[model samples]
Target: MLLSSFVRKGLLFFLLTCLSIHISKAQFLLNDSISYQPKKLTTLGISAGAVYGVSMFALNEAWYKENKREEFHFFNDAAEWKQVDKAGHFYTAFYLSALSAQSINQCGVKAKKSALLGSLAGFVLISSIEIFDGYSEAYGASVSDLIANAGGSVFYWWQQNHWQELRLQPKFSFHRTPFAPLRPAVLGENIPTEILKDYNGQTYWLSADMDKFMRFPKWLNLAVGYGAHSMLYARDATNTANGYDPYRQYYLSVDFDLTAIETDSKFVRGLIKALSVIKLPAPALEMSKKGVKFHPLYF
Candidate 1:
């Protein structure tokens, strides 16, 4: 339950940040390296701070105002949603850190410095949301969530420092699931809500850039994915009581590395970069406790 709420809010937070970044990207050469400029750094810092302040304020007013406040507390939800929500935290954090690093890098900061600061920025931004949860009567902060968030930032930082490129990229995909109708209040009543709240429909993938290591097609990636279904409730026991047998799903699929596609137009390149976060529909082999199934075009 807490995971669903957090994921919804996190998605909104990420979208807001991406909007700010898209606007910034248009005004500056995102890839061009300029000489170290202190004024640009200061401006970037101010801009980021402003965005953070405004977004946090908005969240407090719009999302937290209605929830009853309570003393700070810790929640244990490690068993919820089959740990699919944890993967979401990792995915969101990685992209947030990556985006932050990219933004700072464009401001004339060195790669290592930018990455370090950006990773920290991502961690702080996401972790701060837990404060609201900690004080809410409806939701208490989860230690597992904090750990997932940290793991994501650290993973991004390590990759930036070592490979200097994403060899294994985290990507997401979703499809409408019948399970959402079973419990609309929990799973979601509509497509938009279902996309964020329905764990059954969501797949998190680790797409390995095959060409990065060996002789493979540059644009082709091999992806391993995780998902779950038949979950009308967050807990397996509760779900089973409701006559829904929830089970974890694993997938093997092929993905496209849009970054590998050569494009002369900056707009096209930027579009590709932005779209890279989505795992495109492809033939996939799904493995679960029930049995293995194949989808010709799985989303």
Candidate 2:
């Protein structure tokens, strides 16, 4: 568990770093951000249909185990399985069909036919899953999941038709921290020329370690992080004699976009894009700080 936590934290940190860069860069591309065009409607429909059909068969075994009964197979309980014990089986097909429709739409499925085909695909796919789950002892099918699937299909279509806004910033930001790590290598030359002359009394710019990661700004897949690091007193120079450095040498920084989407950038677009075959959900961004100041778009 401890190791897992460390790994999880490390992954989060890495992702945060990447998002910071992605968003900063996306801010620059001043074009119609939302691209809508469907492709491969039928292919998605067929594939989803077949997969869900097979899945129903597996669910029968799960359902049998869940009921504390001997494992049941479609062949073993064909008569009993025919009974509509599960309510969501139909809806499962619905959602799958919806998903398949969405995929086809994304893959260049056209309108009218595309919408029809997408809807058919969703119904068929989702219903097929329901059938599979009907037989599972561990997992049962319900109308609720199917209803939810329909709602989801509608939701996707609503967004597709009325995509209010899109702000994908797959950009990179750089906040070089020269003042950090003042501890020079031990047994080395005392205060190298570059260091002594540079950081002695100069007020160095303490920006984020922007280069450490990039950002993922596709649609609303906005991931951002303002480097929260600190500036510590060098061991050689804690405090000069008696007069305290008064500036409170403790180092801490917090910078990030304050927006409506900050709460779930990773949950929505980031996860969806990752699960998909999207190679460039977040294209590269132009990262150099533009003239425009950062402000909350929703606010």
Best candidate (score: TM-score): 1
Per-residue lDDT, model 2, residue 182, is 55
Candidate 2, 1-299: lDDT as tens digits? 11221222233233223322222221111123325432343554455445444444444443333453334333221112111111122322333333344444455544334445655555444444444444545444545545545653454344334432212211122233443245333111233322222122222112222322355322233233121122223222343343323131111222232232334455554443332211122222222223223323210
lDDT of each: 0.80, 0.32
Question: How well does model 2 score by local distance difference test?
Answer: 0.32
If scored against the real structure, what TM-score would every candidate get? 0.92, 0.30
The candidate that wins on lDDT is 1
Q: Which 10-residue span in candidate 2 carries the lowest summed lDDT? A: 78-87
lDDT of 1 by residue, 1-299 (tens): 44437454564466446634633342111333657878877887887777777777877787788889989998899999999989988888777787777778777788788778878987887778889889988888999989999998998889878877668888999999998887787877899888888899999999998998999998899999999988878899998887889999999999988877666787876677667888999999999998999999999
Off by over 4 Å in 2: 1-46, 62-99, 106-108, 112-116, 123-143, 164-272, 275-299
